[model samples]
Target chain A: DTAVSQTPKYLVTQMGNDKSIKCEQNLGHDTMYWYKQDSKKFLKIMFSYNNKELIINETVPNRFSPKSPDKAHLNLHINSLELGDSAVYFCASSQGSGRVYEQFFGPGTRLTVL
Target chain B: QQQVKQSPQSLIVQKGGISIINCAYENTAFDYFPWYQQFPGKGPALLIAIRPDVSEKKEGRFTISFNKSAKQFSLHIMDSQPGDSATYFCAASYLEDDYKLSFGAGTTVTVRA
Candidate 1:
């Protein structure tokens, strides 16, 4: 069984369009995260939820919002997507908010905004 | 600002040779350091990790060397095979920061057989 899974592995949208990416983890982890990998392959953490509570919120613009319906799912919604939003988005989960725990990642979703 | 810095954006090595990637962090608060390997179209996976207390750690052909005073860490791949070709990323996180990791720009390594 896949420990972490994402829907719509690829997303292609036009500028000003809104899109959402869904992520789910069956590892029974308490913390879930959304990360963006730019063309330079620099991975940056966007948001993190621990037990459905917002814990980490980076300097991302207001166009992007993350919602966690429960501890197992975290979804990312992008509003008025721009060309700069083109990148690979990855979902990750960990046992808890501890440094000793290793985060498990899901196959990334490639987002291309034309 | 980039909290972690990685060098040699890309590398090429022959089979059975050694591949090395280096990284440095500016935050002394970071207590955990990890190296993640990623293939095309896949998310990064944890390859090896080390803590400040330990200077070095080895797992299979992957080894992590950490320098506490310098706030630097490195990943060394021994007997690198063609299958070892992938992008490697170094990351740092503080225990008190809820495990939110700050990643370095990845290093793409190609092992020619």
Candidate 2:
């Protein structure tokens, strides 16, 4: 079985549009995270949720929000997206929120805003 | 600020040669360091990792050499093959938190046969 999965492998949209990317993990992990990779291939942490609590919120814009309905799902919602929002988003999960830092990542969601 | 710095943003090595990527971190609190491998259209996967306690770690063809005093670490791939070509990322985390990972920019390695 797939450990982690994300929907909408590719998305192309225009500026000012709203979009959502869904992520799910079946690893029975307690912590989930979202990362963004820009055109330069620099990966940065965007958000993290552990046991349904928002833990890490990076220096992202207000246009981006992450919602975790439960421990198993974390979804990203972008409102009024801009051209700079074009990038790849990855979802990851780990067994715990403390020592075990090895994360299992899902196939990324490539979002392009023109 | 970028807590972790990686060198050689891109690399090309002949098949069966050794490929090396280096990384440095400013945070002394970082205890765990991991290397991630990513291919096109896919998320990065954990290739190997090391802790400050060990100076060297070897697994199969991959090796990690760490210098705690220098706060630097490097990944060495022996007998590199074309199939091993991919982007490699180095990340660091503190002993206290699991919510965040400070990542290096990334290095793209191309092994030519």
Candidate 3:
């Protein structure tokens, strides 16, 4: 079974356009996270939600928003996308918020803002 | 600021050779350290992890050597094979928060037969 899954493996849109990426996890985890990987391969956490509650919001722009409908799903929506938004976005989940638990990641979504 | 720093952004090893990747963390609060492996077009998978309490951990051909005083850790792959070629990431997290991880850039390893 696919533990964690993401939709729209690839997204290409023009500048100023809006896009959304959906993620789902079958691991029955309580915490979900969204990460951004730049071209330099630096992975940074953008947002984290625990049991549908927002827990961590890094210094990310307001254009990016994360929504968790339930424990099994978390989605990211970007508004007024810019050239800098061209990168891979990954979704991950963990059984609990504790550092002792291992996280499961889904196939990343490559977003290209032309 | 990069919390976790990794060395040798890339590596090349021959079959049966030993491959080493090093990482250091600045935050003393970090107690959990993990190494993840990622293949092309796929997400990273947890390989092994270590806590500050343990000095070393071994599983199969992969071993993790940790130095709590130096705030450093390393991953060693024994008898590397071509199948081991992939990108490795080192991450650190503390128990204070929801276990948010701070990751190093990455290390691309190519094991040639």
Q: Compared with the true structure, what per-residue lDDT tens digits does model 1 show for residues B1-113?
A: 89999988999999999999999988898988989999988999999998899999999999999988888899999999999999999999887887688999999999999
Q: For every model in order, what is the iRMS?
A: 1.1, 1.4, 1.1
Q: Please give, for residues A21-75, the per-residue lDDT of candidate 3 as tens digits.
A: 9999988899999999999888899999989999999999999999999999999
lDDT of 1 by residue, A37-82 (tens): 9999999999999999999999999999999999999999999999
DockQ of each: 0.85, 0.77, 0.85
Worst 10 residues of 2 chain B by lDDT: B94-103
Candidate 2 clashing pairs? none
Model 2 chain A: ten consecutive residues of lowest lDDT: A93-102
Give the TM-scores of the predictions, in the order they appear. 0.98, 0.97, 0.98
Docking class of 3: high
How many backbone collisions does model 2 have? 0
- Give a tens-digit lDDT track for model 2, residues B1-113: 99999998999999999999999988898998999999988899999999899999999999999999999999999999999999999999985766268889999999999
Residue A112, model 1: Cα distance from true site in angstroms: 0.6
Query: Cα deviation of A43 in candidate 2 (Å)?
Result: 0.5
**What DockQ results for candidate 1?**
0.85
Candidate 1 TM-score restricted to chain A: 0.97
